[model samples]
Target: MSSMSARRGSRIGRGMAWAILIAAVLVTVFPFYWMVRTALTPAGDLFADSHALWPHHPTLINFKRVLGMTSAERARAAGGSGAQINFLWYTLNSIIYSAVIAIAQTFFCAMAGYAFARLRFPFRDALFGILVAALMVPPIFTLLPNFTMVKNLGLMNTFFGLVAPSVLMTPFAVFFLRQFFLSIPKEVEEAAVLDGVGRWGAFWRIIVPMSRGPLITIGLTTTVWAWKDYLWPLLVGRGEHTRVLTVALGVFLQQSPNTQPDWTGLMAGSTLSVLPVLVLLIFLGKRLVQSLNFSGIK
Candidate 1:
């Protein structure tokens, strides 16, 4: 009788779990479905079937037109270049900034987090407390001061302006890495120290290799943030020569046709923009989830 009751309860819980999983998947995927559907809709009928969630007659003209515009922008840029938008250069610039910040943040943030998590130091708790306090200050509050500092340093409209600000170890990255570092056993570090390895040496040769889970997590997080960053990149990268993909994308949308905006083209461009992040997530999803599990999410 007890075994029969346990089986009934297990079946009920399993049914509920499956239902919740399907609902979650639908909620998350509904937006992408809409984006693609809109991208395929005829510009003329965009408002006709307002509730339509699927494409009736998919078209390729939008893709051709968007690609053509993207190409023209590149050719014009290869020449002396004037005030017109240059998607290629801007895209290249965004990639460079994002890649650099990903590498820098991973390297520097890991080291800083290790020190904070393990090493003995004067005012360690107090210093970490200050850093935690910094997390409360909204990024908007720092924009003006950062802009002014950039201008004073003659870095306005330059790569330095875009990347230097992002290179700093953010509070979130430090906290993420610190949680993973704390999970590591201290005896391993002590063994390295007793074997004549210096602090930096052990960190480079031992700790880093062992901390791959959190490192990959932080790298992916930073890369995604850098790719989607718009406000700061727009302010510092205003010129056609330096505009990033987000800015270039906005400029393209602003010039769409009135009756039937280029749906296919917008979708193609957007799909391309999202491809990298999606691929990275697919490959690193396990590592990302592991870090989050250890970190205790806010």
Candidate 2:
């Protein structure tokens, strides 16, 4: 009888855990479903069922307007602002901004991290401590100074200006890579040195290949951050040459002269903005998980 009760209790616990997981999944996924639902909905049918699981009249017209395929009159009739937003151009700008930051920051951070982990120099520990401490400082605190510097350099509305602030490295990236580098066996580099390889060669040939997982992890994180960043880009990249998708979405939201905002079009733009990150996460997410699970630094 006691054994039967224990088995029943275990079953109950497992059922509760599954229930909680399903609830969490619903909470996370429902917003995306709602966004897509609203995007698919026609302007007239939007208010007909606020709690709808699907739109009454599903159409691609909202996407057409957002992509500049529809005429201004048609877009207005479909409850969109008649502005011809250059969504493709903005997307390209976002790609460039994100790619530049990710590649440059990852390479520099790996070098810095390798130096901090391997090289012996004066005040090395103190300098690394200072870099780690820098992680405590909020990014917003530095925004004004960075903005001022960029403005002084007259890099506004340029890709260089958009990427300059994050192009080098972040304290967190350096710290993260350093911890991983510390876990690597020094004998590997020693073996390379014995083979007549120099420090730079050992780093490039041995350390880099060994650290590919962590490097890719850092690169993906930087890309996602640069893609979603809005404030700095809004301040520095307001020009047509460099405006990213996030800033363009904001501008599109406000372009409507009507009292009611263009909900469908705005949601469509948001859906487009979310796609690249979503696809990225889908493909590389497993590698990111594996990198984090590596038995280093623990």
lDDT of each: 0.74, 0.88
Against the true structure, what is each candidate's TM-score?
A: 0.77, 0.93
lDDT of 1 at 34: 73
Model 2 TM-score, all chains together: 0.93
- Deviation from native of the Cα of residue 131 in model 1, angstroms: 1.9
Candidate whose TM-score is highest: 2
lDDT of 2 by residue, 149-168 (tens): 99999988888888887899
The worst-scoring run of ten residues by lDDT in candidate 1 lies at 74-83
Best by lDDT: 2
The digit string of per-residue lDDT tens for model 1 on 114-208 reads 99989999998888889889899898898879988888998877887878887977887887787778888998888888899988888888899
